[model samples]
Target chain A: MTGREPIIDIRNVSMRFDDTLVLDDISLSIANGEFLTFLGPSGCGKTTLLRLLAGFESPTSGDIFINGQRMNDVPPHRREVNTVFQSYALFPHMTVFENVAFGLRRKKLPASEIKGRVAEMLALVKLEGLGGRRPAQLSGGQQQRVALARAVVNRPLVLLLDEPLSALDFKLRTQMQMELKHLQRRLGITFVFVTHDQAEAFAMSDRVAVMSSGHITQRGTPQEIYENPQNLFVASFVGEINILDAVITGHAPDHLEATIEGRRGALHSRRDYPDGQRVKVLLRPEDLRLSRPEDPEAAEACFSGVIKECTYKGATVDIQVEIEGGKALQATEFFNEDSEDIDYRPGEPVRVSWVRGWETVLPDD
Target chain B: MIRIVKAAYVSLVYAFLYVPILVLVVFAFNDSRVATNWQGFSLRWFAKLFGNETLLGAAVNSVLVGVLAATLATAIGTLAAVAIYRYRFLGRKVLSTAVYILTIQPDIVMGISLLVLFMAVRMPLGFTTLLLAHVTFCIPFVTITVLGRLKGFDTHIVEAAQDLGASEYEIFLRIILPMILPAVAAGWLLSFTLSLDDVMVSFFVTGPSFEILPLKIYAMVKLGVKPEVNALSAILLVLTFCIVFAAQLMMKERREK
Candidate 1:
């Protein structure tokens, strides 16, 4: 995705509603033909950013550029962008065909071309032969497909989707996630998706921008974000993370020496840190390994504690181990087909360790 | 015994409501000039009603006022309701509350106030004044009807239209108007009916030169109850029932869609 021209550019944009600032100074660039997602919780300004791009709102300050054209003064109808609202916002009085054909009609396309394009778009969404039904007569999933087809039929330069799949059940949501990803690939257009669910963002987006408090906390691929989070908020928001207190005592040529949970170990980091500086070590639950205290591998373990609880999750068991100094850490262990070692009883003694370089180290804030 | 009591109770309520209208409808076909005795079954009064030029002229005048007032009120009221629902301007809350208050105000008070306004303005009391008074009172009913329909509307649909390349005027014409057509039609019908048979407001504003159906009927009844008046009342009653029935059917269709 490097060296590609950006389709949308937001420069030093800030939005204020009355006395409260909804979005602080922020800037972002989305490359052409790339799928990018804005992932955040509610009131995090993800939807506000998407609205700014769609021309439904104007920033209190700063300029927006789409295809190198200033869009701050352009009204929504004249902009070459479209949106799929969270509620699906299908015109209730119109049939599926008319709703899908609305944009084409507005562009003054001929009748025959509008009919052909609407049929092709509906077919892409797997809603063929159901064009004559009103929105009220269709199921929720069907209405969602109509909304998608309606926006994409015009082939806008950019498509803005605001939590477009949050209304579906688990099975349908996952299925639509795959379909949306595939649709973006087939269309070859830039897609800017906004969602609060991290898993949903990772499933469909090529790059995810994690947002908090109206700020873009981190931006990277899903693997980069998970393995090397820039801050504690980004680390905890992307997935389940266990934070352990660590203090840097000294530095070696390759790795730093830290006192972690009353045990001294070599911590791998690329950034330089001063001696005796306080830091926090972050680890994913799935990376932690568990074994019995008397096992030979226990010699390399970091801490020994009694198992507090075990939850069976069909494919894996989540174990809560109370380490030294009353700190509880969660470790997820997968079950092998031929072994029953994952089945552990409460109050059983266990040894917890992980690969030395797998942890992410960040300064305490 | 309980069934008999329930039946009697239902019959009493129905008779109390419909007995007067039934009497008028029955006497419309009487051959005799006096309304008390039924000489024979004939359409004599209806025939006389058609030949009487004064009654016909008054009927025409009432319809002209009703159509003009209802059309103007529907246009103004629909715009007012949309503004109240969509914008966040200053005094919006006060304006909405004022609309509700007008809907519940007494007709006699409105009539007197309108008469005083016309007199103060030095406007002559004729068709123009009558039309203005009818339009003034009919606007609140139209606004209330349209606003009731707008309360359940989802505003996101407007945004969706704009996102799909619809201008403001296009959105209103193609999306909002079509969706709220049933309510708009019902409001127009209601205003028309109210203007057609309004007696109190018409009494204050209308001059002697421009006689309307209701005031003319009142004057005739003051002398004695005639068969011609009964025949005219029956016709007006049937016309009102048809309007109400049509409005209800439009509402049901909207709900079904």
Candidate 2:
């Protein structure tokens, strides 16, 4: 609760495999009972970071304190953290009840207490009646739940998930994501989940760290990351962002005027950047609007372009307008009677307008 | 027509390989005094052989030595295979080379060399030497058979066992060993047959005190070919065939499971 105390602290941790640096110096912490996710593409060292926290590997030069205990040489079994791998890794020869009871058995608990706790944990994961069956007999999701129950029965301080839902189908993964999040909240256990799916991380974690090339590029709440990204990598990686090269013409307090191609326009962002700097403006498709350039109420710097691509997606229509000088502007028209007015076929010229008051301008191009 | 000719050629090759053994068995059962004549069948020679104690003692000795040699070879070979498969350290190549020599060396050379080495060490040459010779040759065969199975062994299962909190010893005892049991048993049975049939090594290693069934049969054949040896050969053939057949059955069961 104090500013100086964090439940988990990682400082300047780096992992080098031979000559290649697998994980660069990374420092971060999680407060008590925080659901944190390390999200990135494959081989981005997110899994390596998770393994470091679980005491599977010692950092090259850094300190990891778990609940105020320095855990440099501690083995994974001796640590207060447990990891659920993507394979589920339930013992094939043991029954569900025995598998769930294994860790406690290793701790040398009494038989009566072990039996009681095994049943309780299995029921907590909704696997009570299936105790007699082996892991091979269970479905993918069921086995995953058994793995979760097995790890949690020991009451580890932290639960580490290494792409636990990567093996599930889309619908099953979403269902399990919700279930896992709820289970973590109910148990009041800090869950550090590692995955590469943006939607899964956003849907499950209280905070997500987007890692790239062995370093965290950005870390924030799902809303903060989606609404405000610090760089082009973050903007493009976190969500769907359409980036356009623009040279700054003038700088204002709230917005920047820039020349995009031969067209001159103004782009709005809460973050201020220097004028006449070559920057890329990130525009989401939903922010662009389609209108006729002849409209008197339209904003300044309107140019006409032929529709390059169009796709109908449920309630909205996505139209890509290729402006003069081959600039593609992606615009979405809301489906309704209003869509009829904005309806334009591919190769038809129409004015593609974007709201400069919401687009993000990037610097250090 | 060419396919039919190929099929006929395959059949001819099989007949060439097996028909002589069939002929030997048939003549052994015939009551003819000569090699080609057919007379009434009788169990007179087999009955007389059962009354003789020396051939029976040699047969019993062969069975005992075969069991001991196979068991020892299997245990040592299984441990060596597991150790080499699980860990890598120095002297592995040298040890592996020694084992390769044991397997690939000619039987007569190995027999003569072991005889010289045993004599140089002032070792007793009897059942002990015979058993030692059989076990040495069988060890390499057992190791090779089990090592092939170990090469395909799934290490993930061991890691999975550890992740579920099983200790290192328990993983080996419960998971890895059980998964390779069929191969180990096959190796043991193979060693048993090889020890039973070893003539060259047994000839160099045996003494006047201990006699194996194969050496006794050879001695009998050189003295005067007996219908008794024919009867015993038929029985030994059946026993060896049964062991090989049982091993194949066990292998098939493992695959099915």
Candidate 3:
């Protein structure tokens, strides 16, 4: 995955469906043998981008390159890319073995070789001894495995997956996610996956690109995206966060001081910010800490609040605190059987605080 | 009492529909020359039907027209249905609506309109005109049946085929054609029966030279009731029932699969 040339380069691709812009000028590069995921909500153009790469659709503008060759005019059959469609799209009339062998037969391979390869692929997907069964007879998860085997049997240079697990149950989906990641590593093929589930993308991808309204708002590793999102949409879409409207009051070479509705707080940012600029301060739910009035470490940026709601989630108890200026901040505290901490009721008063560098400031939208 | 009344009503409906055909079939084997009296059971009328030169010639012409018109109609209708269902272009809605309209219009009106079309083009009302009219009307039936099958098709299956390195031509020959084959055969069978049983339309376009079986039966029936005509009608009924039965079987297999 490291120090390898990108196998698929999508350069400035834009797709318009009649009057609606489905994919804005999007550029992305997929490294060889790496699994990259396009994560977004429905109608966010992730599927459209995948289709453009698979040659199922031609972009309204720009070009695509695969293996250092321009593929603007390559038809889907001529391109060395295969897609596992969302519906599985296995020919209903064909058995599992026949479906897996379709591509091999299309290449005019000998009958004996086709049979061997198909049997090997079926075994790889752990669907051995089920070759004679048709798609209709298999369960949804089994059908999905067959679809994967069929596409992988073709030995495509890139495998494109368009929400192939969206149809499975949650438990099956989670199981398949691990299996798919393991298979991708073992096969060492470049995979471009499109999905709307952030947790699934984080679990399976080497890199994740978060898209919103036909544009990618952020692209990075899972940790970077979670800790450092570039925009408000990406921050909220990836996880839960509390956004505070703030104005920069003073600034120095390395840091800046900001006020949230007359409350003083010091903010640190790697990027430069001009003085008096308006911005939104972001705080993750787990980052905010709850304390009592007698705590000595409850220093600057502490807000006196009353607990409004508390929900125990087995592993952690989530408490929503209503602080000054009528703003609510949610804080999560993990359970510790060994510690001698007291749990507070709904109407108890408390203080909400975080460290100095815990906040992220972004330009107000 | 209510159950008995319900049974009586159902029996009455069945008898009303089947009695005339049953009489026609049974009287074909009547030895008497007159159909009003059944003197005995025999195969004399069937023998007379086979020996009649004029009726046999009409039967041959009808078979020729039915086979030719059915093949041509199925080919054109399958292509038209694929275009109407798969692609979006200018006037697509109107074209499909026109096909629907052709199916529902009265047969007399279509026969008259086709007669006018042939007359305006100065085409002689003979084999060519009859064949042309049959193909035109049969196309809509074939298209409608095929379109019904196409309604449930998942186009992504074709895309998946292309993804597996099947070219456009190969995909059509291997995937699309095989998937829709049952419906296509049903359409062809339906067209054949429609052409074979046609009388009103054939009466308008079929000239004196290219006599067909249906018109010959009509001409004979106009004279009087004859046992020979009964045998011919019985044979024609069996032929039509066989064709329609085959079509239903094809459609049933498609549904079950």
Q: Could you tell which candidate, 2 or 3, scores higher by DockQ?
A: 3
Model 2: residues with Cα > 4 Å off, grouped in runs: A1-5, A291-304, A315-320, A327-344, A355-357, B1-10, B24-28, B32-52, B91-120, B140-154, B200-209, B214-230, B249-257
Candidate 1 all-Cα RMSD: 2.9
DockQ of each: 0.77, 0.33, 0.70
Candidate with maximal DockQ: 1
Q: What is the TM-score of chain A in candidate 1?
A: 0.97
* Count of clashes, each model: 0, 0, 0
Docking model 3 quality class = medium
Fraction of true A-B contacts recovered by candidate 3 = 0.79
Query: What lDDT score goes with residue A6 in model 1?
Result: 93
What candidate 1 keeps of the native contacts, as a fraction, is 0.91
Tens digits of per-residue lDDT, candidate 2, A230-320, equal: 8888888876777788887887666677787667877777666677688887778887777766665444545578888889888888888
Name every residue pair that clashes in candidate 3.
Answer: none
TM-score, model 1, chain B versus true chain B: 0.96
Candidate 3 per-residue lDDT, tens place, A4-114, comes to 799999899999999999999999988999899999999999999999888988999999999889988898898999999999999887889989998888899999999
